[model samples]
Target: MIALDSIIGTLNLDDEQKFITYLQKKNKRKDAKNIDLFKLLSKSTLDSKAICNQLYQTKNSNAYHALRKRLFQSLIDFTANKNLEDENSIDMQIIKYILASRTFLIQKNYQVAYKILDKAEYLADENLLYPILNEIYHTKIQYAPNYPKINLEDLIRKQKENQNKHQLEDQLNIVYAKLKTVLNSISHESKIINFEIELNDILKSTDIELNESLSFKSLYQILAIANISALVTNRYYEIESFVLKSYEILKRKKETNKQLYYQIYISYIIANTLFRNKKFTSSLNYLKEMEDLMLLKKGVYFKEFILKKTLVEALNHNYTDNQDKAISLAETILKKKHNDIESLLDLHLSLLMFYFQKGQLLKAKSVLSKFYHTDQWYIEKASIDWVIKKNVAEILLYIELESDALLISRLRSFKRSYSNYLKQIGQTRILKFLNLAEKIYKNHNYLTSKTFKTDVEEAFERNTANKEDIFVISFYAWLKQKINKGDLYKTTLKLIQKQ
Candidate 1:
């Protein structure tokens, strides 16, 4: 529904204007009866405005009946044109049938619009081989399925065919084949967490069987999800081979749907890479373009778009207006439903940073409860969260340590719980004791007595995160050492880096 439906492909400014003029001259957008099938998809937002109010209210309504008539008539037109000697002229006419219906979708008759596509697909399937069919299959399947959509056996057969043929040169085909898998995976009522996992592994694996039942460009678009997911985990390096393979194939394309869709996918991948690598400003810019492009029907699935949008929102929001809808959806699915706790940790941590930036201490504290002592993560989440905890504590310490009235008032204004987990768990545990030590140190009551100094050193010694994540544990230890009282800080950093 976005305006300025993308002027896709390699169309120069003049050519872009020419296309826009052609649409205007055709009077296509205004033609409720004519229906322009030439422009349904152009890597631009299919501004539903063209048919937005054109829906037929009754079966006998003039526009409704006209649509029904066109559906059958277009079929005949495509059939007759397909049998013609020359291919060029015939192709445009059949393509027109597809675009007309695309406009009709905005007419609010999803079924009629889908029905036309079904007829087109049937005619096209009869007329063209699969590579082209794959182009429309995912989109059509979303609107309506020609066959039983969830033919798992059929999909499995296709996957096997692809597996047998998988190779680096066949990378494009392989990706589309996987896309068919992606479509099938989500078509069912419940979310298929394992399917996503499989999808991700396929992207990260070096031993790909480049078996493709579809075109190369489609494959790139399909694999974009896996690549983006990997990017979030700082594992973009794992997907580099697949990403390069996808990009090369896309670069060779002559700007068809596959190419356009691939551009959207790769651009998002690039934006995500930028985000993960901490190029925040560049990531923001690229993701804005990617989000716009995706709105133009660039990505597949509500899940993919929502997840990516969440990432974009997290990076861009300043005033708490955006809930990072994508991230929220990801958290709701991946955390609450899929049990992807590691992912939840990352998503929650980002939101925590969000709340922290807003100085919404109460909300930050609420979120921190979920993050503080998770058992699931053995990787980035645990390490990063632990580090964040220390950073916040140090902030508290610094503000309180000045022992001044203004800073004390400012600290109190934060009004967030600084972890009663310490009180519950007792002072023997590092998190608890450090909680008290930070409070005391800020009051300047620490280092006041030999007993207090002993307490501080004891807490500092225990500050070492010995269980796992040596980079984190060791970093904390390093700080302790620099402060002149840490016991294992140096040794811990050494061991963790070895990991």
Candidate 2:
């Protein structure tokens, strides 16, 4: 059986109440302890042993395990029945139509069966649900002899075409999985790898194209791959045209709500990409579009995308010289419990930057303290890139705080931990940055020298395209602030504006 407590933990207050009522109606015995077991599990504070003792007046592993099994089965049933009851779910509606069609066919009602199949087929086709359409086509061909007007050859041809589409979808699914693996594995690495080229090579091998003929799901997967690539390689500018084109095709498709999840996510990708590429105003405009889409179906996906929406909004606002607004947005989200651990970590680090730039050293140090988890925990939960950013930020904060010993300690720890990884990822600039930061911490006079400023500028690449990643610029702003004796926020904005 599934982990009973894990599933229980996912239920909200209303879901828990509905589940309790469901159990009440289904309970055959007044002595049944399944509801009590569920309630204890939902609380998630008691262990299995403690729960068993309370339920059985002793340590009864067998009884507790049996009750847990029953609860898991009930959750399975309730969730399945809930899906069937969701009128907004097109997949469930198609399944209902297909099952009804099958029932009518078994009852020898050929006219009704054909009508139901047609409805199922229309819905499936509109949603690009090729697998379901294949099943519907199979049922139709099986009963084709009962209806003289049924086009047998046409049905077979359609099935073949659908099989091709489904095969392509399966290929894209593998590509999506591969992209996710690469993203999770190499997010910490620098520009040593040409991830976009590697992904393009894979797509070329499969002959996949971002075109109108591809289904909504396929386009979404392709866009998702591009988004991951952009995130990995920091090349959001390169994928803007392709993402926009795929979005246009997504809009032209029928039954948009059927793929609402994809639509919402694709909009997020666009907005985030625009933000990364320094198109702040356009990014906010698309964020508005994304919010409108989130309001559909009674805001089913609002909670899911809230962190992402807020993150992008804050980043835009932060870069646009609205540091107070950015900090407020991030702080508001941080107060809530969100599953987006990565985003939360990001917000914490962003808050550090915001407060640091505003010359609020104490607040910046407070934000730094919130990163209480170990480096390994952060690397697993977020990314090594994030941990690196956090470490660099902490070192900078310590420097500003004039904690010489702590600054030296953090500088040494950072180098000892990431020096090899930086070399492995061809990020020698970061190592050089650590050296410069250490030098400044040791003397404090070298940071303002013309020679040190030239060395700093030479250490980092001045991209001809002048479109450095925002986080990269954020980290460099500390150095720039020292070099020019200027405002941190102004230095960051000037650096980006120079690009």
Candidate 3:
């Protein structure tokens, strides 16, 4: 059953009263039982038994259930009618007028029908609703015999123009949808290698010509695809170029239905690119811009943008060795409520990494504890890559705490599980890091011995040269710090800054 609060919230007090009046009028009764029940439930403090007794003079479960169902159905009907009355979409209004015109024609009211049809045609043409315009043209052609003022040839030509425009828009929308699906599916770093190839294939198959004649929708789609592809491939420079170009286009176009989205997307791409390039201060500036853009639009997408902005800011702080700032931002994210399970899981993993980087083993373990107890439903909802990162964080925590026995056991389990998983997914870099970390842990004492400092240096040089190994969790920096007896955080910050 729909919650009483949801129904009440959807309709304000005035609307709820209006709906009740509508129910009474529809049922042809001055005293509607459902109205009494709705008023009782709106208070929301009374128990079901009290409401049932008050309405029916008895505490009967079956009667309460029946009344609840009836109220729910009435609410649905009221909402539908209210929406129909309040709708403002030009396309939908055009369709409504066309239907009304057809009804009038059926009633032999030719003058009224033609007047309504003319209004619909004007609305459709003004809004560039080509499909609706075609419908209006067809309606005009069908009734042209009754109205000698109508020019059949002119109507046919207009219909052909609208049909061509409709076909073009449909093709662009199809390409946009396909690209959006591909972007969603290939979000992980491991899957990024195929992103460019997949995008190229899509472009080839669609045969879309990106030229001056392309519509804003097509331009937005192209920018989105390029932005996501750059992110996946870690091509920050390429993303920066796209961001600058898209920003110019958006500024030139002024406000549109997707203006806010484009603004947020460009800001996020710029911020993330700076972050990846180790320009933390510059990245923070762009992130602040993203936050301000988010404020202009208050909705679910806005909330999502805020979460993303916070996550990027936290990473920036963490990479710059500002542990306190990172921890503060991460804590704020954790305190807030989120409906997006994937984002929540990502925040948890990031927070855990921040605590680990700060050498606060206990705090890191606490973060992992929260992760461990994540709802099974949330676990299922999380991406496979995120879950793998969580597992890696857990292993890292065990190693940091020097829990040798537990670390060894967990490493063995992780090897068997993740080796096959990563191998199958072709994430060989992560697999290599896992294997290397296990080997280092087993020979920890030997590696730290005075005579083996050269060995550690050699290991660092080998891992750093590969590029892929350094991309995975800074294991090379950790080895360098251990070998030189320097601060791990300082070494990590320096290494990243150098990059």
Candidate 4:
């Protein structure tokens, strides 16, 4: 049986009271069992036995369960009805208008039916609800024989225009879907290397023409595909042209549901592009713009944008040497609820890194403890790159703790888990760094030796030159500080300030 608390939690206080009142009115009983059950389950802590005893005068599990099922069904019905009344769907409005027109037509109320049809047509055309417009056109034609005032030629012309728009929308959606799917599947190094070529191939195969008259949805899709491609291919500079074009289109378009969504998405893309290009201040500005746009229209996709904005802001603060701000933002994100497991894992990893960088060993350890408990779940749910990052973070944490035994054990386990995989992904430099760190930790006597220091410095130089490992967290910088006998936090802060 579903938990009573869970069902109650899905609703607001207003909705709960409405449901309770609905049940009371429907039952017309002085003491309705379902209403009583709802009140009891609404409590923070629910004791099924006590509820059963109070309601049935006996502690009966079967009776309590039966009442719960009835209450759950009633809640579902109430919610469903409420949702239907609260829906703001343009397509639904079109259907309602069309059905009303049909009813009026059946009663031979030609004037009222035509007026309703006119409203439906206007709503459909305004929203570009082409599929529903097709239905509207069919209804128009069906009633045309009954009313000669309905011009068949005009209706046919409108149908053709809508059909062409629908086709264009379909093509754009297909290209967008393919680009997203392929981009998501690009985990291997080889795929990343050839990402641009693959993206071009997808665009070519889709045969979508990018012209000035392109619809807002098409333009947004183009920007989205380009943004993702630039991100994965490390070509941040390529995104500016697309961003400019999208902005130009958005400026020309009037405010609509599609325009609002496109604006939010484009703002996010601009922020991400600036972030990737190391323009942290500018990126934060764009992020604020995105947040403002998001606030203007809190759509169903609001939480996704919120998470993205939060993560980017945290990263910007972290990279700008604002550790306190970074730590605060990341911690706030960890507290917020998220539906996606991968996002939660990413936030946890980011929070752990922030605490470690700030020298908050206790907070870092607390985050690490949580990470370890959830590591297996993450590994099962996330990408290989995510797993690699987590392993590297764990190794770094162990090193910081200065527990040689645990560090050694972790190093060995990391190698066994990822050494071969790193080589496959052209990240052998990471493996080399891990091996070097393991050797230094094992031979504690040589940690301060000139020879060991030179070796560490040389390894850092090699890894730094690779550039591929630059994005894989700055283990090289950590090694550099270790060899130079400088504080990791101070050294990192100095480097960030220079950036």
Candidate whose lDDT is highest: 2
Q: TM-score of every model?
A: 0.34, 0.89, 0.67, 0.77
Per residue, candidate 1 scores C-alpha lDDT tens digits across 1-499 of 2122321332334444555554455444464443343234333343343433433323344554455454345434544543352333434554665787768766656667666666766655444334334534544544443334445455455434434333442554565466555543333221233444665666675445433333444455445555534522335545645654655564564433333344565666766654443344666776676666666532432234444555444644321234345335434544422223344455665665544434455665566566444222322333423333434443443442353574454344322332342233232243534444345545554444566656645655444332332223333442343244433323433433433
How would the candidate models be sorted by lDDT, starting from the highest?
Answer: 2, 4, 3, 1
Candidate 4 lDDT, 220-259, residue by residue in tens: 7888888777655556666766676666665675644554
Q: Rate the local accuracy (lDDT) of all candidates.
A: 0.45, 0.83, 0.69, 0.72
- Give the winner by TM-score: 2
After TM-score superposition, the amount by which residue 337's alpha carbon in candidate 1 deviates from its true location, in angstroms, is 16
Could you give candidate 2's per-residue lDDT for residues 1-499 as a string of tens digits? 4577667766767778999999999999999998888878777597777878999999888777878888889999998887666534888888999999999999999999999999999999977888899999999999998899899999999999999899999999998997777777776432245676678767776877666677767888998988887776677888898888778976886666766777788888899988888888999999999999898878878877898899899989999988889999989988876666687788788888889888999999988888888898888888888888799888888888999788878887888888987787666777888788878878767876787988877876464244677777777878888887889889888877766
TM for candidate 1 is 0.34
Single out the weakest 10-residue window by summed lDDT for candidate 2. Answer: 187-196
Clashing pairs counted in every model? 18, 0, 0, 0
**Regions of candidate 1 where Cα sits further than 4 Å from its true position:** 1-245, 248-252, 259-266, 297-304, 316-348, 368-499
- Cα-based RMSD of the predictions, in order? 16.9, 3.0, 6.9, 4.9
- What is candidate 3's lDDT per residue for 1-499, written digit by digit as tens? 5586566655545677798788778776566688788877776688777777888887687877877887888888888776566433455678889999999988878889999999998776654566778888888898888878778889888888778667766776776677666655654322333666777777776665544334344555666667666545545555666656655655565244443555676677778766765667989998988877777634424765777788888888888768789889879877865655566677777887777767888988887777645433443566455666677777777877888887887777767755765775466656655665676677777665764556554544544421222235365666567667788778877777655
As for model 2, its CA RMSD to the true structure in angstroms is: 3.0
